[model samples]
Target: MLHDAMWDDEFPHDPTICYLNHAAVAPWPKRAADAVSAFARENIHQGARDYPRWIQLEHRLRGQLQSLLNAPGKGDIALVKNTSEALSLVAMGLDWTEGDEVLISDQEFPSNRIPWQALEGRGVTVRQVNLDASDPEAALIAAMGPATRLLSISSVQYASGLRMDLERLGRACRERNILFCVDAIQSLGALPFDVQAIDCDFAMADGHKWLLGPEGLGVFYCRREARDRLKLTQFGWHMVEAMGDYDREDWTPASTARRFEPGSPNTLAQHALSASLELLLEVGIQRIQEALQQRTAYLLQSISSIPGARILSPSAPERRAGIVTFTISGCPNAWLFQQLKDGGIVCAERGGGIRWSPHFYTSQQVLDNALAILRNALQHYNRSR
Candidate 1:
């Protein structure tokens, strides 16, 4: 279990600002910033003196991702730019036939939708399942036709914060012999994820959201058996075996998942993310999960108490992770968002409501103050209307 003192040290002492937007770019952990700072100082003082140490750190990050995702092997994980790029690898790599169908949710983030849609030129079809149904899983399963070759979905809906039952979906996909892909950007760090249990073929997530790291670097998990089936679309020296041997003209793509890696690594982002992953590992996933649940419960209790406010997210605990979205009756979402912004409340506008996302380390006082400001803004909006 995580001690309160351990999590409390993460929030820098900002007197007036309330930051509850971990579903977006999280405020980096203290250790992460310190790691970057130390790296900068090392570069300023001595150039490339510790290059070998940096390579070791990158390897460590890969190992951490292996443990975090419970991948079949470390070779299944590829360090990529973001979820979009990883998903594109599968989209373009797959041998698609005309009339082949891909199943996805109507509410999928653009990343999941656009890549499959890009295949329209090849005469591939994209089937969208409605999640508003009582049984979302059943709806998605029913939409799979004989022509359906793959299913891609976000583990959690970005705006509504609705978590899907990945295990159940994975089972259904296996039964149908369809390829399973998950865009886990929203739930990767906020909730516990085990790819082996889910039996997914491909899974990817960006490090920025929920992972508390910099943008432009993400983790992509490809099942070892599935790695050989997909043809490589992008090629570079890094993607080849015996990559450093420029003298050898005879080379082949790596037999491992590293074949997806196109170019040189992002060493800077690696240090920062390495530090962030270290914090999560130290806290442990179960403890971090508990903190998020407690904070979200408290937020729901306080937000529901205010007048003219209605919760837009799922009310049941099983249906949610760490996001709580609400809408005030009299205010436009844009207006309320701007008001909250001006009042130093960091949040987002999504799903026709104001979204508040807090990480495990958010203090109760920040939530209380932000809620109070929101209520005042709502009351003023009511009077003016």
Candidate 2:
């Protein structure tokens, strides 16, 4: 277990604000910030003199991602621009027939939805299953018809904070002979995620959210057996097996997930993400999940205690991740969101309510302060009404 001092040292957020927005862009840990600063200094002074070392750091980042996903090998991982790009790779690369279909939940973020919807041009159908039922996985599985070529869903719904039973869905997909894809942005760093356990053919997530890294860099995991299912959509020197062999007349894509990356690596983001992942690995993901569950439980209980506050996110522990969304009766979401923002409570208006997504390291005092502000605002609004 990491000490309290270590948590405090890693996250030195502004003392004045209560940051409960990890579901959105998160503030980088001090180590990640320091790493980017050092990288910038190196580029300013030495300029590619340490290019080899930078590549080494990138390799380390891949290995860390492999560990994070429990991927079969580092070869199974590709560092992409973000989750949308990764999803697009799969959506466009797959060989879709006129009537082939892609299945997804209605609650998916745009990153997971638009790519498949874009496939309509290719005569591919995109079906959205409502996940508000008592058994979401069962609903999804039952919705997969014979033409369903893939099941692409988020591990946790963004607005509702509803965690899916990935393993069950994977089993269903396997039985139906349909490909499984997961948008893991909501669950990757907030909860324990295993691609192997889920048996997903493809999975993707951005570093800026739960991973505590910057924008413009993310991970794409392609299962070893399913790698060849998606045809190559992009090609470049960096993706060739004989990389740097400029004189070679014939070239083949690298026989790994690197085939998905056809451009120069984001070395700067690599260093920052690597540093952030190092902190997560050191503290351990299971511990982080436990801490986040505690925080979510606290938020759920505290928010429910406030008069007229109605929970929008799933209340059951097994059904939720880091998000706790709620609304106060008779209080407009926009106005409530502004009140919280004005009160130094950093949250989001989502799913007809305000969403509070606290990280594992978020202090109890921060949660208390945010809830207090919320309570006061609701009470004042109720009195006026």
User: What's the residue-level lDDT of 159 in candidate 1?
Assistant: 86
The TM-score of candidate 1 is: 0.97
- List, residue by residue over 316-364, the lDDT tens digit for candidate 1: 7778888899997767899989999998998999888988998877877
Question: Per-candidate TM vs. native?
Answer: 0.97, 0.98
**lDDT, residue 87, candidate 1:** 95
lDDT of 2 at 346: 85
Off by over 4 Å in 2: 1-3
Query: Would you list the clashing residue pairs of candidate 2?
Result: none
Tell me how candidate 1 scores on lDDT.
0.88
User: What TM value does model 2 have?
Assistant: 0.98
